[model samples]
Target: TDLNWPEEPIYKEYREAIKAKYQIDRLMKKRPNSRISIFAKIQAAEENLAQSQAGENNSDFDEEIPF
Candidate 1:
């Protein structure tokens, strides 16, 4: 069975949305004395970190399983 799958529209939409959100957050950070913007950037960074960690964990788990 082929494990490769084509990318779906929903996934593309999600990727685009994440990219746009991050860009907005990045621009917000450039504004001095913008506490609200800073907070938003921090939140976005934390969310990205959590997602990265989860992906790493899943990859490790996959490697541990005997095929």
Candidate 2:
């Protein structure tokens, strides 16, 4: 019996990071009155996501949870 659960997405760390990056980018784009330009934020997010995907930093960003 293989103890490793290949079917579980959570078992893959990169998947979780990608999911978080997508959610953060989506939220950042939705803010209407943010101090920084939406385009800038998006660009920053892209860079951050790239860094994360490269197995660098994995910092958590603020995301709104739908109730």
Number of the top TM-score candidate: 1
Model 1 per-residue lDDT tens digits across residues 1-67: 2235456544767656765867866776666668778889999999999999989977877778899
Give the C-alpha miss distance for residue 27 in model 2, angstroms.
21
Candidate 2 lDDT by residue in tens digits, 1-67: 2335456565557666665867866776767656558778999999998987766334433344454
Q: Clashing residue pairs, candidate 2? A: none
Give me candidate 1's TM-score against the actual structure. 0.41
TM-score (C-alpha, index-matched) for candidate 2? 0.30
CA lDDT of each candidate? 0.75, 0.66
Q: Give the CA lDDT, 0 to 100, for residue 17 in model 1.
A: 72
Model 2 gets an lDDT of 0.66
